[model samples]
Every structure is written in structure tokens, then in C-alpha cells.
Target: MLKNDQKVFVLLENNNPQVESLSKQLEIPLITQKQIDSHRDGFFLAWRDNKLALFDIKSPKKGMSVEFDARSMEQPSWPAPKTGTLAQAIGKKTKTVVDATAGWGQDSFHVFRMGYQIVSIERSKIMAALLGDGFERLGNQSWIQQLNLKSPKLIVGNAIEILQNLEYIPDCIYLDPMFPAKRKKSALAKKPLVVLKGIVGEDEDKKDLFACALQVAGKRVVVKSPNYAEPLGGKPDLSFAGKLVRYDVYFKT
Candidate 1:
């Protein structure tokens, strides 16, 4: 794994101590955003519009940064929570879920919006840092804080190790290990996944991750897969199908 210092640096919007504090937390070089123009070969974390974001230095001024927004009403699937594929897989009985591969955290956030306590585990510090920023933003909202909605806990480590050592077992273990898109080309290329793949690459120990989830989940383990890929957990006890994806459910016997 490439160290954050080797691949990422932090750029402050101005001279803010809070931004600097965030930079230190990421453990990468800190510089003013103005300095980004001269250094455009690697990734840089920048503060913009009151949000923490990841920017590629090469086109720092041209494109958007990775931002996670966890507000329930803002998410596309929140309106009909019970109808979503992830909600179906989780069902009403699930009390807690550990999202073992929280790529961009969409599924984990969805689970949280549906009222299930969720924990997100991402081995990629790049993703974890971005996810942390997102959760922090959500925590500050008056409505959320007033209602006492807790942000999903983020653990920056391999899920296999974290799962094996959890203080308490989760009702469901969720896995969405990265799989290449089934179709070669699509109208809307998923830029987040593209940028993520550039940072984290593919999961090489997917089978082992599934095995670990099976061992730790109290009630069941669920794996999300593209329609074209084989089930990650071999033959599942049940499966929930969606438009472009499916969830393989393996109940604990």
C-alpha cells in the first residue's frame, strides 16, 4: 500500500487552524490551495465550500472532489427506503450491520438511513478519510444532532482483522468488494469508482473476506454483486435482486 504521504497532500482553503488540523489527521503534506497549481502530479485534500474534499492535483481546478453526503432526504433512495435492494437484503429484523467493504459508503449510509445501526470498515485510508469528512458534516446538522442520529462508525483497517476482534457481533455482515463493471462501457461512467480504483486497486483476498464475514456475523452475511459476477459466498441461502445488482444472503445455520 502506498503511504498517504507518498500519494496525497493537504491543501488549505486559507489560513484556518481547523483545516490544518484535518491535514495533520490525514498525515500528509499541508499547503495552501493556491500552491496546488505548481504541484499537480498527486492527490490533494482541499477544503472547499465548507466541506472536506479530495482533489486530483492534475485537474484540481477542473473537476469535483470526493464528497459524501449522508443526509436522509438528500440520498436518492431514501424516499422509499423499504423498496431499495440493500434494505431488502437487510430486512426489518436486522439490528446491526458491518459494511466490510465500504467503497464510497453509499450502501452503509443507506443502511443507516433505514434505521439499522451500521459500521463501515474500509482498508483504504483515502476512502476512510473522505468518509470521515462526510460523517462529520452530517454530525453537525441541527436536525440530525437534535434527533440524536448517530453517524456510522468508521474503522480504518482490514475488515477481516477488525471483524475477528469486534467487541460485539453484528446481526448482519455486508460485503461489497469491488468488482469490475459488467458492461465494458456505459453512458455514465462511475467516476468515483474510477478514482477509487486508482487509489485502492482491486481486492485480492475477496474469498477470505467473505469467509471472515460468515464467521463473525451473528445472524447472516450479505454480499452485493453485479449481475454478471458469480456469488461471492458460493451458494447463498437467499438472494435479493435489483436492477443492476443482487445481494447474496447466507443465514447463519
Candidate 2:
């Protein structure tokens, strides 16, 4: 069994005084580690916040793998269409998407499965490492070989810079950033997410992300928000409903 004592130095978001103050005021833990390495292959960073147990690898870009349950990769089955997913929203108008905040690549995978080509970006090296590993595993899956599932093309670096330089503008740019959890009582209980949150920190630059997404998207930008949080970048011209939240859409001219 892999020991839990593994530790690596990662820049803590709370290392900044202002960040630390906010973490204390908001009561959010900061991120601080990179995880498991393989001698033959590259290392992976664990997304502690994700319940899905996703791990992205450290190197080898493009056709990156995403590992969900080991069982799911080996077995051929489509992930249930998350009915109210952002994929469904943008899929209606665009055949391609850029997940500007790819994170653990959950939403990016969903977008790809919905038949849209995806360009995903992540800034955190640890998160990118985890994502890279996950994509490598995803690429090697027997089912993926048999069925030819669409795999994400991941780029490690700031989306704000990468998106601006992309040759083609995608139909949609999706953002599912880290927002303050709804309630403090509800926060402490999300164990899987807590770990990830500790490592990635909150999406401190969500505002810039939204602006950049708006500029780069061909048709529109969809921002996923908790039901209780205010719409990002003000009210959306249109919105699609989900049980617990809404997809706020900002159409581009």
C-alpha cells in the first residue's frame, strides 16, 4: 500500500500574508504538496478535493490521460450524460471547447465525451502533473483503444496566456473555479475535496479567468456557480438550470 506520509514542498497559497489572512477569515486550507512518482514513468499530483480520485501526471504533454476508477478505464461504458452539464449547454451551439480551468479535468472529460474537441489548461504544476498522469492512464485504457474516446489535449501553464495565443477560438470556454463553499459547517465534511482544496488553493484569479474566457470563446463562455453564489462577472444573459446550481452564459459577439 502507498504510504500517506509522502510529502513534497509546494508553494502554499497562504504563504502570502494577504492570502493567509483570507484563508483564516474564510477558513480555507492552503495547498502544499506533490505526490507519488514512478521510476519508469513520471510522477502524479493528487487532486485531494475531487471525490473521483483523479491524478494528473508530471510530464509528456498532449493526449494526456485522465484516470478515474481503475475499473472504469478498463471497462467500456459511457459516463452518464450529466443532464444539466455545461457540456450540454455549449454543445448545443459549439463543437469545440476550452476548459480554461481544467483542474482535475472532470469537466473537460465530460465536454470531450459530449463530442466536442477540448483544449484544457491548468496553471498549477502539481495539478498539471496529476492531470498529466491521469491522461496517460486514460490514453492506455483498453476501452479507449476499442472505442476511440476523445481525449483532452492538455497544456500546462496559465490559460490566460495560452488562450490568447491559440490559433483558433473555440465555440465555448468553460470555467468551474473554486469558490468559497456554501457554509462553513458544510465545508469541513468534504474530505476528498478538502485535500485538493488544500493543494490548489481557491481560484484567486477567477475574475481574470472569466474575462479571458470571454475574449477567447467563439460563441459564449459558461461559468458554473453554486446555487447560492452570485453570478460571476455579473448576471448572465441566459442561464441553464441544474438541481443545485446554474450555468451562467455570457454570449460573445
Please report, in order, the local distance difference test score of every candidate based on alpha carbons.
0.76, 0.65
- For lDDT, the strongest prediction is 1
Name the best candidate (by TM-score). Answer: 1
Candidate 1 lDDT score at position 188: 45
Q: RMSD to native for every prediction? A: 3.3, 11.4
Candidate 2: lDDT of 217? 85
The 10-residue segment of model 1 with minimum total lDDT is 70-79
Question: Residue 233 of candidate 1: its Cα lDDT?
Answer: 81
